[model samples]
Target: MWRNTELVRGLTLSLALLLAACAGAPQRSADPQQAESPRPAATQAAPPELPKSSSESPGAEPALAETPMHADGLEPSADTAANGSSPPMDFWAGLRSELQFTRCADEDTQSRHWTKRYAGYPQRFQQTIEQIAPLMQYVAAELRAADLPVDFVFLPIVESTYFPHRSRGERPAGIWQLMPQTARGYGAPMKPQYDGRLDYAQATHAAITLLTHLRVQFNDDWKLVNMAFNAGEYRVKNALKGSKGSRLPEPRGLSPITIEHYAKLRSLGCLIDQPERFNLQLPIIDDTRALASVELPEAWPIEFLAHLLVIDPQELKKLNPGLFGTHTPGFPGYRLMVPARAKDDLIAGLAPLPTAVSARWQRVALADPEQQRTLVLQSGLEWDLFTSINRQGGERVWLPTGTGVPKPVALSEPAGETYRVRQGDTLWHIAKRYRLRVQQLVDWNGLGKRALIKPGQWLRLRAPE
Candidate 1:
């Protein structure tokens, strides 16, 4: 992954210089809804002064702490205190009182606001806790070995609510909410056949590298690291300089303006503030010890592996949310994580398939204007079995398990209009823009299982049916 340390250093230095130039500069607020409102112009005015405290903001309210105790099957109440604190007059307590006393209090309303206060708590706190409790041993172990602040691990709860493949905003993606540029900058390859950012191993490695770098740059300050993570290091540096002589002694005391900027910009800072309210001790996570490695075959389905381990595919997906789909398409092989004890079972299940001896051939048609019909020859036929039928002609074709000569699948059809991919293009978005389903575009283009597309590459979008 470290292609060239010197090149990386040069890029990093350039970014740092760019950040310095932006430091203390008035930041362009990302709130598009407020675009029509009168506001300070970017070049002529300075940023407004930081607010004194959370209370000074127009709708500011104090946070609360409550017991983390769970009730078997009953509706959640504030009475239980996991932290052993007496019911105090905190925001949580008040909310709990409202919940208990109000006649209209319901599970839906409570669930929606539960995460609003606590960053890492599950959205369906009761259900999620029950589900995650069994995996705590595994999660805690990883947390301990990583020596990372426990709260940071829970950040995913805020990012994807433990749901893998969740998409938000304009192309922000995966559990970590990484954008394409940032994800690529961190070593995720944007290629025609693979997106390393969605691969858990690759993503975890990238995340760790980024976190470590941020920690070093910010002098091991977790809050600043978190802020830099959300708003970009440049924005954080600018916020720091804007605070200047007024900078807080530490992150806990950072002014509301800085905290609000981070929260509003990235939608995470307020969530991170939860542990502080409850006085819960953040655990140190050790990633190495918690993750047990299992080798996977080329193009192995991760969902199948999760099933083999008898673990929730969603949970597995959560742990490794960077993968684009159920399978890892190509590259230096893949690794699947399992419980430490299930290593033997996984290994046995993945024993390589016997090699094929006889030659094989298949014919398929292209739906595009080319209406191309192709004849292909191969010793094994796994590609035709796994990939969709509509794909027939392309620069790249999926091959079977064992390597062999790939004879072109001959096509008989007329050529169609070609379209070039542009920046910010996605199969779904592109199909919609051109009035097609994700599958239609894939079939028309003869894309492989990997479905890798790149900017500037020409694709054949068929004429309307």
Candidate 2:
């Protein structure tokens, strides 16, 4: 009985020890697949990084604020800084980064359609791009500063093909293709003397203003905004109101023209987004701001301004197409778009120059029997200034046998006296006659390379002292 009792005690003690050992040991899971295998502390996984929202992300297309135009007319707004990403390398890349609508699968298909069409005529496409490179740079900078979608730069692309002075008979004008009433409503200078629709700077501002207003009216739906931009806003509003059963208006609700315009916007945007997809490389346009607006105290002849700035007169005309005829109107605060490099020089020239007095012009009848004869001035100057002042550069200018020609009646005197150029006089001959270098004569009068001396035109014998 004593031995059995001791054996039972030992057995009980061993059983208790075994149970404790089992309790302290890590238990194996019933299903090995379902086991919770903990990794080392250092090897633990981290939470995934979240993508940024559109508003917070750099290069995201945000709602544009309705800001006033720059205090200096025609100045490009500074670029918005990129946060947490590398900066864009060029203008097209910068523009592509901000594209939103053209990124999706549905939009990609639509945009790619246009890309294929444009790619068909690669040379024409390339020429058009080269032609509008500077304008595109300026417009892109302006759109970016306005906080507008960089895709808005393509508006001009689809509008007038970036023809700033596109003259269509009584239709919407300028690069933005603004209607006359719409242009005037938006405060674009729409006078008979100066058509602001032809002025890129004014038209861009007006178009941006109109677009902003439309965006608000359309509940920020760019598709509808673009539709309204093409067709009248009333048309879009009417379509939306009539579509009682549908959440959005059907494509059939809009006219084919408006629909096409919207498609064009999308397609052009898509082309810009994925040029490579269309088997074409994107053109490399410099991202630099290439244009500046200069407010002139007085209207200066674009020719004179071009000569002073040493730029092509045709380029100056192209930039300031709003100016009537060959000169800017004689009004205060007349603005001129000049190359950025020439802006400071123009401002400097304006500061030191004395206000020019209006010259008294008189009409003198020509006694030439030939109907197409070039009129000579009595002072031995050619009638070049007269024809220029009168804006007579057509192939055939018809004047009666005794038609009147305009000439300046008075001279300011002094400045080493003016010499009257004879019918056969040349710059070389005149320079030798005055004992002056040909360059001096050319410099004093702002003479061009031709140094064309017209019979009866006056020339300064000496430099202004």
Candidate 3:
């Protein structure tokens, strides 16, 4: 007790000295009598103040506010809640909502390969979608119109990355990645002059048509249809033949490639369906910038038409990718794609455009051959434009836009009852033959606005006037 008392006394003295040192001694006057006067207790120093928080002042640095965690935390959302309608109906959401296979299967029981890691696939796909927004949105709208699963819209990601000009192994081309045979089967021409496989509108029609047919063949099994699309119907059938098919209700066959293909699709579908899982955000896209297809029979210069319509020629080419040159090769159903906004103005001012583009001009040599060919040229060149133009290889050929093109032409019309359609016959040719307007010919024939006249379809030469 005596030692404790001694320790407490020592601590007391030390603390008092420390306080005095911290408080600091006040200024000692030059005269000691002034310092002898007692300073008030309030004048003794207090503790230093702390810096102000950001919340208290505008100039202070701020800290992130923490979200308060409850005893019960937030939960993942259910697909269908009280209303049981659906998730959001946007493009990605629509695709996700249609997925029949949601539960991840055990590796031992399932054939799906989760091998392809999520390494930049989502980012690449989002970039590609942005690059081809108009075309993709158009495809999605068509799919919705057909009352089919919109999941097929993502097929182009697997096929060609939405690039219209992509080709593989010297044969397949376009956004759909259709082979020459498949393209022909769907009535898209793949000739040297004009490969219709690259045409966005036409290819979308063909893809949907092909999908419809595949759906029938595979009994509406989209997985099998997708496999058929990727590996061809023959291989898919063979795969189904060997194994009891599981992707569909009916027993289907499976192959390694087909399994891998579907696995890739499923993987791609997941990334698109839930991009947040991969830390990616997709751009909102629409095909609302409307494109109108204008059927013109003559070989018109793309540049001239673009200038007249006030559209960029490069952009116009994107809309009409089938035409493989500066000037359209006058196929029978040559549709020129123009901006829907400018369609009315172009139609109003089309007087500057030539009446005919194909087999409509004949070569005329002048004294000044280069300067005077356009002065006195002739229309009604032979129906066999390929041979006629090739024969005039050495002559200066005047174009519909009054420019000179130094190249040959393409295929001829067939002889049959009321003009059998040839490989490259445009409606203008048949109309001109019967001395009827192209619209009259189309009206009599019941052709769609953008429909192409195929090689063997007989066209009506004359109607009751």
Against the reference, the lDDT scores of all candidates come to 0.38, 0.50, 0.46
Give the Å shift of residue 194 in candidate 2.
2.0
Best by TM-score: 2
Better of 2 and 3 by TM-score: 2
Q: Estimate the Cα RMSD of every predicted model relative to the unseen true structure.
A: 17.7, 32.9, 34.5
Model 2 earns a TM-score of: 0.54
The residue-level lDDT of candidate 2 at 266 comes to 73
Candidate 2 collision pairs = 377-456, 380-421, 380-455, 380-456, 381-454, 381-455, 381-456, 381-457, 382-454, 382-455
Supply the TM-score for candidate 1: 0.41
Tens-digit lDDT track of model 2 for 338-363: 77777897776545333452211223
Give a tens-digit lDDT track for model 3, residues 16-41.
Answer: 10000011112222331112111111
lDDT of 1: 0.38
Model 2 segments more than 4 A misplaced: 1-89, 104-109, 165-169, 243-252, 286-289, 296-298, 330-335, 351-465
Give candidate 1 misplaced runs (Cα > 4 Å). Answer: 1-123, 132-140, 165-170, 187-202, 242-327, 332-334, 337-341, 348-465
- How close is every model to the real structure, measured as TM-score? 0.41, 0.54, 0.50
Assess candidate 3 and give its lDDT: 0.46
Candidate 2 worst ten-residue window by lDDT? 1-10
lDDT of 1 by residue, 37-76 (tens): 1111001111122212212331232121111111111111
Which sequence of candidate numbers ranks them by lDDT, best first? Answer: 2, 3, 1
